[model samples]
Target: MARWGWASFLLRRLTGTFVVVVLLSVGVFGLLYLAPGSIQQTLLGTRPATPETIAAIQARYHLNDPVAVQYLRWLGGAVSGDLGVSIRTGMPVSGMLGGRLSLTLALTGYGTLLAALVGIPLGIVGALRQGRTADRLVVTAGVVGLSAPPFAAGLLLLVVFTGDLGWFPGYGAGEGFADTLWHLTLPAVALAAGAVGLLIRFTRAALVRELDQDYVVFARARGLGAPLVLWYAMRNSLVPILTATGLIVTGMLVGTVLVEVTFALPGLGSLLVDSVTFKDVPVVQALALLLTLLIAAVNLLVDLGYSAVDPRVRLGGRTS
Candidate 1:
């Protein structure tokens, strides 16, 4: 691999980050505006507030200003790490998010790792053993995993493992690491299933395409072992797989919300859902923004990762 120059790479990554942040801010602002009711109702009570109280709340939240002004104010505050106070909890939004963010991150991060570990190998094996029994079995498993909804899987797992067998706690983060792992096992598998299957399919397809490429045939003609040639081919084939995985990872974060709700886990997903339901604007905004940032960061990393793996991708006009 060519040396990836730090200065140029950072510049490229920062540029992309800037663009994504602007788009995210715009999107969030639009969603807030499109929320049911006027800014007063969104930031204040539905009961007719005394004019003085309404004015005070508007001033407090910057709602009295023009949309542009309000956005700029929020943007400034956001840059300063102030997401404002949660209307529902009467606490700082950042503190509340910080409390729950780790749980969601743990669940999603570990589940994604498990998915990648299982899916990539399965895909490689299935592709190599195409038309054989092994391929059939792996493909069948992928199909089932892909087709099953996570919430349904969660429910079924709860019934079989927790309800029938009485083996594991159905919900809550347990007291210790071992207990936590036990509780997380079902939800993690439920969250990972669809993503794992998608990655497998993508990897298989990419591998198939890569094997047909002229370079792969040339490598084979040069007397490379099947495994060696396939490994090289897999690396080249992984661009699409990497891209697909990035998207699936982001999608899993969304799915985590549903999984959390179903399993009664107190992760950021559940917190966000609760905030939305309770009309806790600050919490809702903070959670949404945090998720957006996480997704954006992943996408940026994916771009950099692609440039690292493939010489064809450029960073700062340099073939890296």
Candidate 2:
């Protein structure tokens, strides 16, 4: 593959990503616009929706404009890094998102790391032991993990660790790195449970296929130890695992909504929920766009990782 080819491939992907973000923004904006109930109603609370109050509110937020015009204005502002102020709090959307985004990112990042660390080894062990009792146990555990909801898992953990054992705090993002880690431990585990199950299944399946390949059999026949042969096979099987990992990370970001709500953590998930409940259009729109961009960026990195891990996987159209 030529350098120009690789460049073209990356350029194409970047263009596609931009298109996806645009479409996502349009969809989010449309959905919020079409949702029932007027912003005036949300602002008035229990008060009567008088004609004067409705007109005043509509003019104040430019809600009297056509939906398309409003969307275009918001999109233009987003491009310029001005996401507007929250209707509910009068705070800048960007400023409100900053601290919450950091907390959500931290929770998801640690959860992804923990999932990979625990899942890969479990997968290897299950693959090596095929049909044994250990493999059966792992399979069962994976099934349960996949079937259980994150919030339910979180509640169970809270009951066990915080309720019964009194081991870890049940809520709040604690101060400092160490304290935060302590506080996040249960939430991370709950958030990661489903992802760990998915990784274990994907890794086990990939390894099993790799181990049956000619190269793996040849290496084993040459008197290489089981560990060495498995290592070689694992390298070849990484593409699928990497794909699964990217998806898991994306899911973690989405799943943080439920996990954060369950744990009562001060993260973007909680903020998003509150924003929606209060009909804070600016805050909701900003968070939705940010999450979409984050997912797209992760997927872009995963595509680049393919070429890095396997020389045969040319980012260009032609493979060597």
Candidate 3:
């Protein structure tokens, strides 16, 4: 039964991912079609564009094809690892993404690590010391973190660390691992601050509930030490915290776009914004597709993770 249930869940996730991919592809292609002017004319410009040259360009790019046909052609190319040539740079979309994907991945990785490192502990402290001085301090810090905007945080850091103190690079992904980390520190902190706040709030709330459960009382009655009680209680409380953390991480993926642009970092978010402004359709489409896939994958992973954190969730999912 467990095996069958797991299989069913996997199948459902796969199906949903496929549907989302198709919809995203259609939407991106539709945007290109709906954009002003002809695709061929837009690319070749008005520098004496002959019909012969226009026809040749259309034939080269399948622009003469119907909208559905063009979409299918693009979809077919996408399946075969061809994301189409960039309308602006005449470079392969995959090449462009491959070059910048690492920077974005590094930023997200560092930011998420910082968030978890800071958030989990603060949450634990808040939960353990509920209604005390420590709790109040944690809550106040969480509120501040939640209220801080990533761009504002980034700008402030830039002013203090770069402008005033003359420490760290103001913008750009610096060369070398050490330099890159130094460059990423401020942006990652800015991005993760809110996540830390959210995690603390979630953890405190969840742990408070768990601490009041009958099993917690049983543990206390059995003469368990405060440390043991806290540990056991926290393990159960983490389920909801995990759920909220997953959501925060998902949001961070999109939220990092603005910060990336503001800092002029050579990440996927920056690339997407620049491409869109320049009307680089292929690049924009590919990035959008990749981001959609990434978000869907993250959500799927979070769903899978929930079962491991909470047996009740697994049983509930199976029964439902």
**What TM-scores do the predictions have?**
0.91, 0.92, 0.91
Worst 10 residues of 3 by lDDT: 311-320
Off by over 4 Å in 2: 38-60, 64-66
Q: On residues 1-320, what C-alpha lDDT tens digit does candidate 2 reach at each position?
A: 36766777778778988999999999877755565676567645455788998888778667878888988987988888888787777888888988688899999999999989988889888888889999988887778778878899999999999999999999999999999999999999998899889989998999989988998888888999988898888998899999989999899999999899999999999998998887776787899999998999999888888767876554563565
- Tell me the TM-score of model 2: 0.92
Best-performing candidate as measured by lDDT:
2
Q: Residue 234 of candidate 2: its Cα lDDT?
A: 92
Residue ranges of candidate 1 with Cα displaced over 4 Å: 1-10, 46-48, 315-320
Model 1, 126-242: lDDT tens per residue? 888888999898889889989988888889989999999998788997768888888888889888888888888988888888888999889889999998998899889878888
lDDT of 3 by residue, 1-320 (tens): 76666666667777887898788878876766666788776656444579898888789878767878888988898888899888778799999999998988788888888998999889889988999999999999999999998888888888998899987778998999999999998889888988889988988888889899999999899999998998988888777877877787777788778889878898998888888788787788888888887887887778777777765456546444
TM-score of candidate 1 to 2 decimals: 0.91
Ranked by lDDT, the better of candidates 1 and 3 is 3
* Inter-residue clash pairs, candidate 2: none
Residue 42's lDDT in candidate 3: 62
Ranking by TM-score: 2, 3, 1
Q: What is the lDDT of candidate 2?
A: 0.86
- Provide the overall lDDT of each model, using Cα atoms, as 2-decimal numbers: 0.82, 0.86, 0.83
